[model samples]
Target: MGTMAFGRSGASTAGWTRRRARFAGTAHWLLVPALAFTLALVVFPFGYTFWLSLNDYQFGHAARFNFGENYAALLHDAVFWQGLGTTFFLYFLSLALQLVLGTYVGLLLNRRLHGQTVARTILMSPFMMPSVVIGMMWLVILDPSLGAANYILSLLGLPPSQWLASPGLVVPVIALIDTWQWTPFVALIVVGGLQALPIEPFEAAFIDGATRWQAFRYVTLPMLRPTLLTAAILRSVDLLRFFDIIYITTQGGPGNASTTLNIYAYRRGFEFFDIGYASAIMIALMALVAIVVLALMRLRRSL
Candidate 1:
């Protein structure tokens, strides 16, 4: 009986080892297609962009290797620098507003109440709308002459203000449009986080006489930290390449007040037909986004 038992245990261990080995081999086989796709689509284009950045490549001409001229020209260009600053400003402003408003709405939606499904659907509708449509809608709403915003201001005895036409207000208006579109995404992520949290700690806190705010502060916020960071990082990445709404709304107009890094690059490439210079700008923008992503990933790891 003892000999039979020993033989059975040894066979079981050997079978487990074989299963793990086969799983590893299958995983490697599965990775081949993904790696090939990355090399073909992502890495190849990335390397090509970098190479173009170092050349004065033009249509119908052999690419002239202009090593560092594009980078140097970008340095002395005040407009480029201003656009870069505006890009960062807009990125953060949208991120900040989305986080604040999204958190509020997420908390409200997490409650057990009637019509929650309908309310969530209604709130998320804006995010599903096309960017061009949203921009056009806002244009009419904020039009200085015939917009509802100014009309409301007039009703409140306030002077009608140019929301999008004025340089000072253009970026903020763009930020508002972005917030309206993306807040629901953040709220949805937060709601998922809230739902996934363990209820025992919250129940214990309540039983121990903790107030609602205190329970949230000590129990809920701590649990939601990782989710919030994840949402912020994702939003930041999207905002870094914010071009759709900006392009549709302002076209970086009214004297470059709304011009961001993406707009600047588009103007350089398509408008002026400086393909090499635009590629250089794009590579730089990619670097900036990579840095942000790396930083956020590190923060996520620490959390």
Candidate 2:
């Protein structure tokens, strides 16, 4: 009787296990349609872009597969090289300023100050504005004549300078405007990270007679590494492809002084009608951004 009961229990357990395996398999198969749709959306456009890059694709003209000629032309183009140089300079300069200014703002926002809510809302105004709008706003404010920026400078007994038109000032002014608009985004992220950090470390630091600066340097900074890297990654990707503000503000003026790779790509593809060459530039930029992002992602993971 005991053996018979044991054999019956084993048979029932096997049947239940098989039923669960079948249900799990069915659920996985049910996800196939959504996965396929997502891949189609992402993969098709990328594949088409890559295909266009290999050909002599002129607007409304026959496309001949030129293999690698487009890429070769890009390599030989001095204008393309100059645009790449400008992009790197804009990216690094804006990133450093944003991180520093953003961190400082974040620290201030993290404190319990009077009108904290109102202050945060006001700080977010610039970032909330559209890129084109921000560009236009700054253009008016920094106008060499009849603009508020020069007017303020004149009041301080300084000569009015061309903010956007001057070749030397265009890139730096653009960087400053970018910093003004986006610093709040970094600050908000850092503020949230600060709030989420455990209080134990901070309390212990105070008990150890550490000065506020020492506590920040030794404790807060170490703990905020991941958050800082996340902010960097977000800023880096957008800055690399930044176009609208620069386009609307300088339009790559003063003879390509502020022409970024994005603007150059736009000119090549649309303005100049060299779609194939433009596609090559886009692909190269995509690869460069991918490398930077992947490295940052890996670093984040390792940390």
Candidate 3:
């Protein structure tokens, strides 16, 4: 009877082990569909784009493998260089304005003020608007002659200026417009960061007799690095790839003064039908965005 009982216990243990193994195998199989979807939707398109960039593929012509030639041409392309410069210029300018104004707005919003909720809701309106609609609206508002902006300038006894038509002012105007639209987004992020911060740090600073400005500069700013870095990374990606508003408003006009890499790539691929070269340009832009994002991520980690 004892030997029979021991044998039964060993058999039961073996059965349980087998069942656990089967369950684990089933769990792994459940992940296969998700993996397959990712490969099909994400990985495949990127691979195809990279492959296309290495060829001479035009819309109406036969594709020929001309690896490196497209990228090589970009080296000597004046328009490409100009677009790159314009892209960075607008990116930095917009980012700076957004961060400064956003931080200031965020600090104000953090305070317990009357109608604070109403103020935040009103401020977020621009960011919530569709980019194309904002572009069109601004286009009408910034018209040199008939626009409200010029009308306001005339009311102030200032000379009405060409807002978007002039090449020199177009990029800056677009940057300011973008700042106006997106500053609230950055401010929202900042407000969240401020709320999440520990109260102990501020309390300690005050106890140490630190002035308001000093405490903010030394304590609040240091603690806010990660939050600011997060905001910077988000904005950097959008600014680098900015397209919709620019395409709608300026169309990279006034002799390509506002042309960014996105606009340049669009013109090459759709308008000129240089699909391979356009692919190369897009790849370059992707690489640039990746580099900047990666750098920001590294800084975030350090913080």
Which has the greatest lDDT?
A: 3
Off by over 4 Å in 3: 1-24
Error in Å for residue 268 of model 1 = 0.8
lDDT of each: 0.92, 0.92, 0.94
In order of appearance, the predictions have TM-scores of: 0.91, 0.93, 0.92
- Candidate 2 scores a C-alpha RMSD against the true structure in Å of 2.2
Rank order (by lDDT, best first): 3, 2, 1
Best by TM-score: 2
lDDT by residue for model 1 (169-271), tens: 8998899999999999999999999999999999999999999999989999988989999998999889988899888878897899999989989988888
Clashing pairs in 2: none
Clashes of each: 0, 0, 0
lDDT of 3: 0.94
For residue 169, model 3's alpha carbon misses the true position, in angstroms, by 1.1
